[model samples]
Target: MSIQRIAAAATAALAAVALALAGASPAVAGSPHFIRNATTASLDGVSLVVDFKEAGLEAGAVETIQVTAHLDALYQCVNNGGKVPSDPKKTTISSDVSESDEFTAAKNGNLVGTLTVDPPDAASVLDCPSGQRSTLVSVTWSDVIIDDLTSGASLALTGTFSA
Candidate 1:
């Protein structure tokens, strides 16, 4: 090949290499080093009780009750054994009551006030190319209250996420 032609070809190749290197370097910077996956847990067969006592004029006033729950979960893509997620939010315990009795002082009574409790949060170890990481999550619930009533009052509560 002619000298001028050879020099031009070499310059073109160098330019192409430079462009590829620039593009590739930026892509590497933009690429994420770590990946994440979803995990879930559930607690079943949980139970709580509400006790009632006569308070002044009001009847069947709630004193206190025991609370218990079972926990379960399905974990996915857990790496970095040391790093795990935990729940920082609060859970609530509530109750429901019926007012069919005519002799009841109040149609509905605040048998028990809302009580906030924190439960263990979901955890996972994030696996990454460089290393492992830890993550924490928060759990929350809606308002849980015990209503007023005569007898056979019922209570139900469910877990939820916070806003």
Candidate 2:
């Protein structure tokens, strides 16, 4: 190959990498990684499928993390002919709940966080039947993490909520 051609090729490759780095989201700054996989948790009528990508977390570093999970309480109104309650606070259950637990990263490098759903109350919008539990609220996480590891990376975990 000619000297000019080789230099041009090298320059193009460098530019391409620069562009890719420039366009990357701030959350995923250092150490590109992929989430281990999806995990499903079912308690009472609440169901969740959680997945995320993380970097810089050591295999044994336990940290306190908080994630703002977006909830879907549509099922609470299903029994009432799909009628949504006028008062947001009058839902079958409270969508805003906090869960705290010591999470241990497994050998496979997965930090699993499970949100415990509150059981439906009697004043819930839906007149649920016995054993026909309805999920008052279903929530999802968005790259929620705590503690800084060796690298700075963002978590973008997203998936469908099956409740």
Candidate 3:
């Protein structure tokens, strides 16, 4: 309506945009342009899905998704310090292991859902040096990382399991 009112409104809008950009800019100075929506991330243990919503990856390009985490599992194995698991009845073996799963993401515009390459899940056989076993009794993971191998971009989860 009035000249003064219009100028004040434009200034306020400009200030708001500047503030938002200050917070939303990429961490690195020369980072890629499409890195705006890559902030939020998560890991689904039950479905083994590493999900990124509105990820802001290259619009429809194939992304190589790599996930790494620390794994601790309980197993059942021979009790007499044997490599081969001779028994399957007692759950008396525990080992600290690492599990990493990588897969090529389909061309799905920033919505990345890939299955983890879990050898331990399928094989379930522990060499079981002493108290190791042939069966995976329980599995726990921590320090999870979801990385875009194609773009050399990685997101270290902040919430431990979700982190």
TM-scores, each model vs. reference:
0.23, 0.36, 0.45
Please give the distance, in angstroms, between residue 16's alpha carbon in candidate 2 and its true position after superposition. Answer: 46
User: Model 2: which residue pairs collide?
Assistant: 27-154, 92-124
User: For this target, which candidate reaches the highest TM-score against the unseen true structure?
Assistant: 3
The runs of at least 3 residues in candidate 2 whose Cα sits more than 4 Å from the true structure, single-residue gaps closed, are 1-44, 49-55, 74-98, 106-154, 159-163
Instruction: State the RMSD for candidate 1.
Output: 30.0
Tens digits of per-residue lDDT for model 1 on 55-130? 2223333333222322222222234565432532222323221212122322233232322233333332222234
Report clash pairs, candidate 3.
76-133, 77-133, 157-163, 158-163
1-163 in candidate 3: lDDT tens per residue?
9999999999999999999999883532223222335444344542234444324444455655666666555555545555434445433333333333443333433444543524254234545444443555555555666666666666655543321
Arrange candidates by TM-score, highest first: which order? Answer: 3, 2, 1
Error of 2 at 131 (Å): 18
> Looking at model 3, which ten-residue stretch has the lowest summed lDDT?
27-36
Per-residue error at 155 for model 1, in Å? Answer: 3.8
Assess the local accuracy of residue 4 in candidate 3 as a C-alpha lDDT between 0 and 100. Answer: 100
lDDT of 2 by residue, 72-123 (tens): 4544433344444453332433254434445555444446565453433434
What's the ranking of the predictions by lDDT, best on top? Answer: 3, 2, 1
